[model samples]
Target: MSSRTLPLLFINLGGEMLYILDQRLRAQNIPTDKAKKVMNDIITTMFNKKFLEELFKPQELYSKKALRTVFDRLAHASIMRLNQASMDKLYDLMTMAFKYQVLLCPRPKDLLLVSFNHMDAIKDFVRDAPSILNQVDETYRQLIEMYTALSGGEFQLIRQTLLVFFQDMHIRVSIFLKDKVQNSNGRFVLPTSGPVPCGTQIPGMIRMFSCTGEEVRRLQFPSGGGYTGALREGSFQMFGERVIKLGTNMYSVSRPVETHMSGTAKNSAQHRPAHQQC
Candidate 1:
């Protein structure tokens, strides 16, 4: 078999379509000399069908309008026993198709938001077993990075998603810490300071939660938007101050005011005293 026939091994490995094509070719009693030509044609047709299915599949997240022409070219190239040059072109087309899909049918923000809402779930998994949390944090971080790359660093949405995701994660981490401490008989207490180790912003928080941090940093904030580091720090300080003031006011007003009433019965005595003086 020639080096070119190596790819055909994939056909032998349960490609029913190729089997049917082989059977049809044999039925025609074609000469051995023409069999390669016939097989090549059959492979081309099969590849075209596969490409079409891939392009038009119901779950295909890309926009058909943006990718139809590219798909057509790729399908045709795959069918024609194209050379490596053509195959490389087909790969480029696939890349473009993926990009167009991302641009045209951007994923719903809710998909990410929902994940954030389950931050506690991730934390619980970690708390039950540190390995579980580690795995989840790694997986979630990768997903965040993938989504950010796909969105080309438009991070406002990504940041919003992360915030919600982390908030849920924080609640879960707190729960996990409480559970661990309670179950450990005074043997374990989560660390109280320093950067969290599991993608969590708070200690005992999963630090791997924001895998897209690098991508997020690359994101350009809107015009007039200041550095994210400064903004986040300033916002946090402002929020803390507000909370402190609110707490103080609440404490001062929490108690009820006291009042007293007294009765005086000296009116007649006072009049007698005044008359004696007169």
Candidate 2:
């Protein structure tokens, strides 16, 4: 052996652990080369033996007790020291998901419990005597320092935990067809009595005259109809109306009362009610 001490590159927990971690990473679809790398990554930093032991205890993924144990361990182990800023941000991230409990559920049927998603909402664990904790008036500062020791495994642990956290937060993409309504169970069940909103306008398709027809009809009945009828009553032999200006709004001019229709106008006027002329 050389007189110089060589740095140890790995934490030697023996052959069986190495084999099991290699198998687990491969089970997660990691390639043989990458599995070896990640297996090495999992054991070298931030992970103590107890945490790893609890996390991969050979339990089936579908087992309730197993999953509960897994969740409990995950939550416990991932408790990072949050500064006020981080704590505030985490609250904002979870507040909506916490309040309604809408996007999560308790353990259902054969599935793993979604109640684990409410890790932020379990109050008794978080509520007591934190006032004194906050009163410490602790100040945090970012210090630039060179780190000692190897920490290759920390990133993998964080990545894996974050992957699990986000995967649990998934709300399935739902396309509600006509008459679809969501039930109390957060499932798209039962019929609804409403139309889904969508959008409109064009020429020669009833839209040529009106965008929605309501505004057109409102203008027509109150203004166009009234003006046209007024001109008719004024003894005008209207041939056609032509728009003079058509920007922003329309301006039109119509042929006025004929000089020859004076007698007919007088005769028609005699049959009208006094208030109708006004």
Against the true structure, whose TM-score is highest? 1
TM-score, cand. 2 vs. native: 0.15
lDDT of 2: 0.23
Residue 84 error for model 1, in Å? Answer: 51
lDDT tens string, model 1, 1-278? 11111111111111222222233334444443343343343334433444533422223133334433443342332112333443344333233222221222222322233233233222332344454345445444533543424342343343333333223211112222334631233222433332222222321212232565643223323332221211121111101221111001111222221111111111222222221210
RMSD of each: 36.6, 37.2
Question: Candidate 1: where is the Cα deviation over 4 Å?
Answer: 1-107, 152-278
Worst 10 residues of 2 by lDDT: 138-147
Cα displacement (Å) at residue 191, model 1: 43
Taken over the whole model, the C-alpha lDDT of each candidate is 0.29, 0.23
Q: Which stretches of candidate 2 lie over 4 Å from their true place?
A: 1-49, 52-82, 95-103, 106-278
Q: Predicted candidate 2: what Cα RMSD to the true structure?
A: 37.2
Model 1: weakest 10-residue lDDT segment is 242-251
